[model samples]
Target: MPTITTADGTEIYYQDHGQGRPVVLSHGWPLCSDAWEHELKVLADHGYRAIAHDRRGHGRSTRTSAGHDMDTYAADLATLVEALDLTDLAVVGHSTGGGEVVRYAARHGAGRVTKVVTAGAVPPVMLQSPANPEGTPIEAFDGIRAGVLADRSQFYQDLAVPFFGANREGSTVSQGQRDDFWRQGMLAGLQAAYDCVKVFSETDFTEDLKALDVPILIAHGDDDQIVPIAAAAYRAIDLVRLGTLRVYPGAPHGIVGAYQEAFLADVLEFLAD
Candidate 1:
């Protein structure tokens, strides 16, 4: 369980394995480094240095009461990469983790990073405004916050339903997958989890997308119920200077876990390019 102390003194837990080029992974909201277990093994086995870290208040990382915003999330990731002296890094982020990588590239530039992959991620923006009318309503995000405050445990359990597409008519995910999602969500700090709802839904990454220099692959599920394709990856692809959009037909927000083989193969192919 290797950990790095951020400038703010938060103990960020990370996993570094294998050798060769580094493939850094950032997990989704309320999830941790463990969320990338499938991707990690594949990357490591394929001769890539796989690295995944628990965001500030998730997983085995220290549960701080503050800095649960995108700026801090990106900074923490930057600190980890810098500390490890990793070069030509291929940053892959899922859901909220996508926002983290986009912000990192925008804020820090792509001197060390070579490419990026955002899978089932939130970027550009998720919330509706006068400018971006296609965004999800603020009330929808408010409902998420209300759900978290009401019962953190049950809220996470309920979220796992659609998260893994279990609510669909012909879901490919198993009960164990939903249970695993619940376990990871419950492990996150209550405050950080609640705060992240705002971070993921409200934070704008439009400028970040515009600032991207390195090649970026925007991956999303066409059937994703959590982050709609039309509002997320579709719009994100148009913003990046060097971007490619790949849709996983009939996949869910948790596609990385549900469609592990395809997801890994798609990413490996993108990294090879």
Candidate 2:
């Protein structure tokens, strides 16, 4: 397994495959690069290099007790990109990883990044501070933190319904899909998952979005139950000058997988432009 050592000496594991224009994927919270397995095959078949990393404390990466915040997460990705010496790379981030991509692009500039796509990303801020009156309440995140700390296995199992919009009246959720999600969530370290609640829910990406000049594609499910589309997706689209928002009607937060064909098609078209 290929790995890169962060400046702090943390060994982060990653997967680099295919040979063409590089397309890096950053996964959502409580999940790892395995979340991109479906998308990776699509990208590879279309003649693009597909790479994904198990975020620190998730999947096969080190289960560190500290540095679980967004800053460190962004830095870890930057280190991977530098180690690979990649350019003209298209970064696709989902949920918490979406926050990492925006922050990394802003912090490092557009010289190395060709384009970016954020799906169900929590950004422009998620916590409802005085400055961000429309953000989600801290109590909501607190609930998540407490759940993970108490009984992570059950917590993750319960999370699947809402995360995938299975609770909705017309929603269809297979037992296999739910099982896969639970398996991935359980694979991650409990400490990292707990700490990351703050990283994804509290970090402010306002400055990052304001500074981004590269072409960006913002896709979100209008009916997302995990991270409300109105607060996260809509706000992000408004912040970026060159950002294009593609709303998937009645789709859940896991729209990339739930609506794989359409989502992949849009991404391929966007990359072609």
RMSD of 1: 1.1
Model 2 agreement with the true structure over 215-244: per-residue lDDT tens digits: 999988888888888789888888898999
Off by over 4 Å in 2: 256-258
Best-matching candidate per TM-score: 1
Local accuracy of candidate 1 as per-residue lDDT tens digits, 1-273: 799999989999999888999989999988998889878888999999999999988999999988988999999999999999999889999999999998997897468988999999999899888877878999998998898888978888899888888888888787787888889988899899889999999999998999888999999988888888888998999999999888888898996444667888889999987
Question: Would you estimate the TM-scores of all the predictions?
Answer: 0.97, 0.97
**How high a TM-score does candidate 1 get?**
0.97
Q: What is candidate 1's CA lDDT for residue 95?
A: 94
